[model samples]
Target: MEQKDQLLQKVWLWSLLFFLVAAFTGFVYRWGLIGGDILGLRMSNVRHAHSHLMFFNWVTPVPLVFMARHLMKTAPEAYSSLKWCITVIILIGFASYPFFLIYGYHPVQIGTANLPFSVMLSGLVMIGWYWFGLIYLKYRNKADSSLSQLFYDGALVMLVVSSLGAWGVAVAQFGNIDNNLISGALTHFFLTTFTEGWCVLAAIGIFYDLSKKNYSLPVDKNWLIAPIVLGAPLMFPFGLSVDLLNESLLWTAKFGSLLVGIGLGINLWYMARALPSRNKVIWLFVLAMLALKVTIQLSAVFLPETLWLGQHGLRVLYLHLMLLGFVSTLFFAAFHTVNTRSSKAGVYLFLGSVFVLIATLVLISGLWPPAWQPTNVYRWVTVGAILPSIAIAVELVVAGYSRFKQG
Candidate 1:
């Protein structure tokens, strides 16, 4: 039990560290202290590190840790080995990412050049998925706790699908494939599977776990399950060709985004209504996340028409706002809740992070205007970036200390 607690503690520490590195890189880059074109190899290298650290190091570990709590109670062997494997892989992956950044290699290039390391990392992730799936299936068969069991089952399925999609993308990149269709399909499969599938499912699981502890809102298993049901088939044709569905695909993506927005909005609204009147921090955080979602959908609407928005910069801004503002903030809030027991300090940390993130998003998005001068825009972005790093660091320290003391 003590070992399990320590493992989770380490995961939290790594999450915080990687998050800080990403935040710092964004701050420096925006400030012009890092001299390079945003689309150049140098910037791509940094962005690669930023994305992997955020997704694998920070995001992936959260649900694994959350699931660990339940697995420790039932499938201790799987939980223990999974933790050890994940820890080693995370350390190795983090260490190698900096080298890739320094050498200005694309992630695919890095993965191929360091095949052994990549294979080892992939094996570790596979072990995590296997163990997590085994535990989830075992618990579901046993049928003990209905709430968490359902959440875990959903998460496990999403994780498996997402992992398969990732593998397909990797194969397409590394394998000598002459077909553009195969390559394009793999890329789309990877993107939507991770962003829309795994991320959303894990988030729903986290929300279920957190909200059930604090509020009496009803959980609709159907709402949690609906995306996978619709997404699986819709993603099939969508991945084959964007032009296949043509205008219909555009409408489908738009409508899908709307449905997602509405579903998430309902969850947040329920949470807001259920919270005590004194919990202003959660309220504000919820509002910020909802705003972030709206921005994401709007960005999607603008994405296919890149000629109007200078495809590269606007797309970058869209991704940053969605990943950094929406997803990261929600994860931070959940991390705070779990680590700090919903302490006032935790609340303050969350609120502070959201405030800074909102400011950063506005500045970056506004910089998209054609008439906007680069110098002034970059200055504002730099200033905006610094605030969020400070806020996140403070939050992590406080939460880490709190968790340590409790343990």
Candidate 2:
């Protein structure tokens, strides 16, 4: 058991290092988008690099560490496979994806088979997910079939499912297919399942896992499961770029938003009661941002025009709410659990959270129909985005120098 804890501790540490890069990429992405020239590259390229590295690299793998806790308990072999898979995630997600940034969209060919860098990375992800999914299935029925586990299971399935869409993307790109609908559906399918299923559900599961320990808070399994599982899939229409006219898709999108709202709403109620007493301000800040994300997301269903908001400034903001606000915050909580901390760490985390929150507000304010955005708002957003990077740097240093402690 001690060995397992120690192994998981290193896993979180490695995950955080990759997250540090993801945070750095966030600053670069925002800086590039806001008209700054750092690498003499277009914002789109930076955005691609940022999103791929952050989402596939940091967001997916980090959560696996948390999920592994349960895997270790029931299926040690699965946990063993997961450890190696994480190592590969670090290679592809951290090492290779960043390499893609350095060499953007340039696909190498072997025997007339053209391969996009993303396509290659996607292959790696599929391989990782195969191992992950198989590992989970090994003792899934033997494991607890609670809401948290349900989300974890769903997320595992989605990872494999999204990889199929990813392969479709590769096929389209390689075939030089210019058909918008084909590519768009493939892209949307991958993104929707990944973001909603893997990212959001995993974060929700982590929250439930954390909440289990709090005497003041009790998790309602049904509340966590129903809306997210049922409603989250509906939310994917937002990712579709091809068809906004289909009545069925439109209504499904709206209903999905509502269900996601209720699910997250239930989460906030329980988390609110539990976090404060634990002095988990970081968790509080993240859960609050999640509320904002769902509210804004679902609002698009009611105020259909709000769908246009993503065109303005909400795209990156929405992504951040899920990536940093929901996903990374949970990782931070886990990191704090693994490592002993000093007062300086708390201050760093608090200030970092404040900056990130302020940045979100600033970005939301920058949305169209209300353009009184703060002058040089990008600079403030950079500070907010980079602050966490700096905080993580400190934490990484502390973790590296400090001895392992009990969870």
Candidate 3:
């Protein structure tokens, strides 16, 4: 038990480090937008670095750690493989950050050979994820099955499906393919499935497992799982380049979006009912973001013009809402559940900063009236970015200091 606790804390600290670096990179990107040219880095590359770092490192692996804890209890024989998988995943994920920031996905000359370092690193990270999935499958029969397990199964399958989209991207780049439709579809496919399918479902599963003790009401299992698993792939191509999708594909995406919204609405109802009364506020905020995300997706399905006109800004806003506002806060609530030593003030600060950051993103997302545009939009965004970064850094430092004193 002590060993497991130590490992969990180490993983948590590493997650915080990754998150802080990503947040700082985001701040730099925002600053570069305002001040032009950050340390001679291209804005596009910096943006890629910030986003890829957050996706590959912080959000992807942190939940895996928590999920492994539950799975470890079920199938203790899988412990060694799970540990190594997560360790390699984290190391490879961290190594990819600088390469992405420097070159995005472009090739780098290495000893007279041009190598796509970031893309190669990303491939290795995906392999680690696959290994993690296989370990769970290999040990599945040794464990009892439940609703949470069903969700994990779906999440892992989505992860694999999302990787195919990612591989398509690498293939297109390597083959020198010039078709914009293929590239756009593949990129959007990967982004949507990975975020909506893998991240959201996995977080919900983790939360369900962690908070199952509070449940007295009966829940419909299939209602929660079917839509996400079947719908996420269909919904992927509904992004910026809708021209790539024919009418059938577009309607498929719309139907998928509708199912996802309905599924998520059901999820929100259960979550609210099962939530412990003590710290319901943060979790409620998390649920609110999830609801708002569903509303936005439904609007895109019905009002197609908004999707085209506000593609850049609205897309950015939606991603932030899912990643920062929903997944990050959900993780925070889970952490508070497992580790009561986390400070309340720190919790409130993190929560408040996340709210501010989401609000700032909405203001700049072109959703508001033109007359309501803030003059200092960039300044507001910068401040919003800084608070969460600072909050995370302080929490990490405080955690380390406490461990040092204990040692």
Candidate 4:
């Protein structure tokens, strides 16, 4: 038990480091928005680095650690395999940051061959996921068929399936496919399924595992898994190049969006019911963002004008809501359970920054009333961006201090 706790603790701290770096990269991206250039980095490239680090390092590892720990409880013999898989995943994740930051998917000449450095690195990350998935499958039968297990299995399937979308992207680039529809569809598919499918499912699964003792009401086994599996692939249409989509693809995407909304709504309802008696406030905030995220998606699909209002801006808003708002906050709450010494000042600052960031994004998206629009939109957003990093940095300081005292 001590060993398991130590492993989880190490993994959790590593994730926090990733989160801090990603947050600071985000700060840089926001600075770029306000015309602040450092080291001649393109905003788009910096953004690619920031977002990938968040997905590959911050969000991906924490959930895997929890799920792997869950499996270890049931199948002790699989411990070494799971541990090594996680180690590889973290290494690959950290190694990926510079490739993306420097190259951003552009092909690099390696002797005679021109290779996309980040793309190759992304492929390795995908392999790491598959490696983890296989480990889960090997020990899955030994584990009980419970809600958390259902979510973990489904999340792994999505993780594998999402890789196909990434491969599609590589094929499009390598084959020199010129059609906007193909490229746009593949990109959105990869982004949507990985974020909505893998991340969301994994988070919910972690929640169930972490708070299982608090769950009193019974949930139907299939209710949570079926909708996401059926909907997420088709749901990519929501962010595709709408101009390139025909009527058939358009309606299909909307239908998928509806299914996804229903699935998330069901999960939220049950999760809300299962909330632990303590930390209800933070849990509710995360749930609210999840609710708002889907609601905005559905609206974007059904109302063409609504999509127009924030099409570009809303996508950014949506990703943050999912990654930072929903997934990151949930991770923080989970960490708080293990380390009660986390700074309250840091926690409040982080939460406040999230809401401020969301608000500025909504305003920037043209979703807010014209009268309420700020004169300098970029300035507001830059401030919003800076706050989260400051908050995270404070937490890191406290964590380091605590560890030093322990040592």
Question: Candidates' lDDT values, in order?
Answer: 0.59, 0.68, 0.82, 0.81
Question: Residue-pair clashes per candidate, as listed?
Answer: 0, 0, 0, 0
lDDT of 1 by residue, 111-139 (tens): 44654344445545556667657655654
What lDDT would candidate 1 get against the real structure? 0.59
Model 2 Cα lDDT, one tens digit per residue, 1-407: 35455666777667667767767876787676667787676566666777777776678777777777766766665656677877776677655565467666667665888656665775776787687676667767766765567678767766776777778888898799998777877787778767876788887776665564434325556656677667766666666653443667667777877887777787677667656334376666677778778777767767755446336456556766676666676666655644445234733564466456556544655454445666776577666766777777877766655544433
RMSD of each: 4.8, 3.5, 1.9, 2.1
TM-scores of all candidate predictions against the true structure: 0.76, 0.85, 0.94, 0.93
Off by over 4 Å in 2: 33-37, 76-79, 109-114, 213-223, 241-248, 273-277, 304-310, 338-354, 357-361, 364-371, 404-407
- lDDT minimum window of 10 residues, candidate 1: 233-242
Tens digits of lDDT, candidate 4, 1-407: 34555567778877778888888898898887778975898778889999899988888899898888788778878878888898888888888888788888898788999978888888898899999988888888998777888899888888888889999999999999998888989998998889889999998887787664655545567877789888888878767765776778778877887888889888888888887555678778888888888788778667874436426877788878888888888877776665665455666667778888888888867567779877887898888888888878776777667656655
Give the runs in model 3 whose Cα sits over 4 Å from its true position: 214-220, 242-246, 304-309, 405-407
For model 1, what is the alpha-carbon lDDT of residue 248?
Answer: 67
Ranking by TM-score: 3, 4, 2, 1
- TM-score, candidate number 3: 0.94
Using TM-score as the measure, the top candidate is 3
* Weakest 10 consecutive residues of candidate 2 by summed lDDT: 338-347
Candidate 4 stretches greater than 4 Å from native: 110-113, 212-219, 304-310, 341-345, 403-407
